[model samples]
Target: MAHEKRAYPLWTELPYAGKTHSPTIAGGVEPDAGKWKTYFIQHSRRHGFKKLDGRPIRLAIKDPDSIDWYAQLKVVQHTLENLSDQEKRIAEYWSAGPPTKQWIPIVDRLIDTYAIEAPRAARILSAVFGGMNDAFVVCWALKYKWLVPRPNQLDQHLATYICTPEHPSYPSGHATISGAAEVILSYFFPAERQKLHRLAEENAQSRLYAGVHYPVDNTEGLRLGRQIGRIVIEELKKDTVNGLPIERSSREFRNADIITRTYEQAIPFDYKSKCDSLLIRDDESTGNSSTKDWIDPKLFI
Candidate 1:
C-alpha cells in the first residue's frame, strides 16, 4: 500500500514558506496537537455537566493507493485551476482566522436572532465548543497518525490560492468544526437547519477552493464531526431536572432578522485590494456603506 512506502514524503516541510528556513524532519507546528485528548481523559476528575467519551469516534479513510484518492486529488487540481470569483471569495472569507474565530460570531448571531436566555445560550455555547474541541482532538490524532501528505506535497507545481496551514492534511479542521457547529446549532434552532447546513457545506468546500485539502479530507472531517456532535447532544440530554430533560424556549427577535437581511444584502468585498491600512469609506454618490462596513475589514488584511 502507498501508506506503507517510506519513499513518499509525508507532511514534513512547510510548502508555502520560502526556501530560507532549513527543512528538518522535526515536529511541525503544534507538536502537542493531541494534548486536547487529556481534556476528555480528565473530565471526570473535574466538575462538568456532561462526560464525553471520544474513544468510540473513529475515522475510516481511503488509502493513498486507492483510485478514489487519485480522483480526489484531480478534483483539487481542477478546483484550483477553474476557481470562479465566488469560489475564491468563499475561500478567502473562511480563511480569515482559526475555525473557532468565525464560528464565535455565527453562534452570537444565532443567539441574538433567537433571543435565547442566559441559561440556554450558555448551554448552546458549551455544547458547540465542546464538540469542536473533541473534533480537533480526534482529528489531530488521526492526522498525525496517518501523516497524510497535503495536496501541494503530492504535486509540487500546484500553487494554492491561500497559504497552506502547517499541519498534516487528512481531515480539515475548518470542515470538522463547521460540521460540529452545524449539527449542534441545528438541534437548538431547527428552523434554520437548511441555512446552517449550507454554511457548513460552504465552509468545507472552501478548503478545496483554496487548494489546501482533498475532497476526502473535508468529507471525512464532516462525518467525524457530525458523529461527535450527535454524541454531545446525547450527553446533553442526560442532564435532566425532575426526571425530565431541561428545555428552553426561543423567541424570535425581529430586529435580528432585519439586521441579518441588511448585512447579507451588502456587496461582497474584494480581497485582492492593495490597501495599506484598514479603511472604511461610504459611497457618498449612492449614499450606501461599502462592503467593508458590513464585513469584517480585518479579514481582508
Candidate 2:
C-alpha cells in the first residue's frame, strides 16, 4: 500500500502499521510457531510450564479458504456500502492503534469508575493486556499462514474510513485483542460482563465499519481471542497471596456500586503528558501487583 502523505498520516496509517506482522517474520512455517517470542515465555517460565487447563494454550484459527469466498466478499461490500457517516465516526473511535493499544483508556476509565484499589486494578490490567498480547501472537501466525487478501484487494474502488492495514486479512487484530480483553476483563469485573462483551463485539465490527476486514476475519478472530484469554485467566487464577486467589469475586464489582465508564474517539492535545497515569499506571514504584515484579508488561488493553 502506497503511503498517503497527508496531515496526521500516522493516525490513518500508523508508523510500522500494527498489522504488518506476519507469521513468516518469526521464522517461516515452523510447527513451533506457538513458541515464537511469546511474552509469557519469559515471564511465565519461572512460574513453571503452564497450559490453558490441561493442554497447550494455542488458538486453532479457522482456515479462511474453507469458507465460500464470494459470500464473505458480499458481507464486506454490504458493510462498507451501507456504512453511514455516524457509523464511520463510531468505527474510527474504536480503531485502536495496533497491535490494539487503544483499549488502555477504556480500562483506565473502568478503574476510575469502579474506584478499584491500586493493587487490584493493576492485576486486572495486567491479565487483560497479557491475554491480548497472547492472542496477537497466534493471530499473526494464522494471518501469514492463511495469507488471505483484504476486501479492498478484491475491489479497489471500495472507500475505507481509515487506511487499510498492510497485512494478510484472515484474523482481524483488533477483534482478536478485543476478544481477549473482553474475556479477561469480564472475568475480573464480571459485573460489567454485558457491557464489556458488547464493547468487544463492537470493536470487532469496527474493522468491518472501516472497510478493512471481511466478516470472517472478525468472526474467527473473536473466537481465537477468547480462547487465548481463557488460558491467561487460568494462569492468573493460579497466583495466591497469603493463600487466597488473586482473582476477586464478582459481587465486589457490581455495576450499581461503581460509577459508569464510557469511551470516545477524542485525543487530548497533550495526550503524551496525561497518558502516563491513565494508560500505564506507575505501579512498579508502589509494588501494586506481584505479576509486575517479573513481567512488568506494558498495558495495551
- Top lDDT: which candidate number? 1
Give the 10-residue window scoring lowest on summed lDDT in candidate 1: 273-282
lDDT per residue for candidate 2 within 50-69, as digits (tens), equals 46343444344665546665
The number of the candidate with the highest TM-score is 1
151-257 per-residue lDDT for model 1 (tens digits)? 76666556666656656777888888788888888788777777778878888998898777898889878876776677777777677898987865443333333
* Backbone clashes counted, model 2: 0
TM-scores for all predictions? 0.74, 0.69
Q: Alpha-carbon error at 215 in model 1, in Å?
A: 1.1
Checking candidate 1 for backbone clashes, the offending pairs are: none
- Model 1 lDDT, full chain set: 0.63
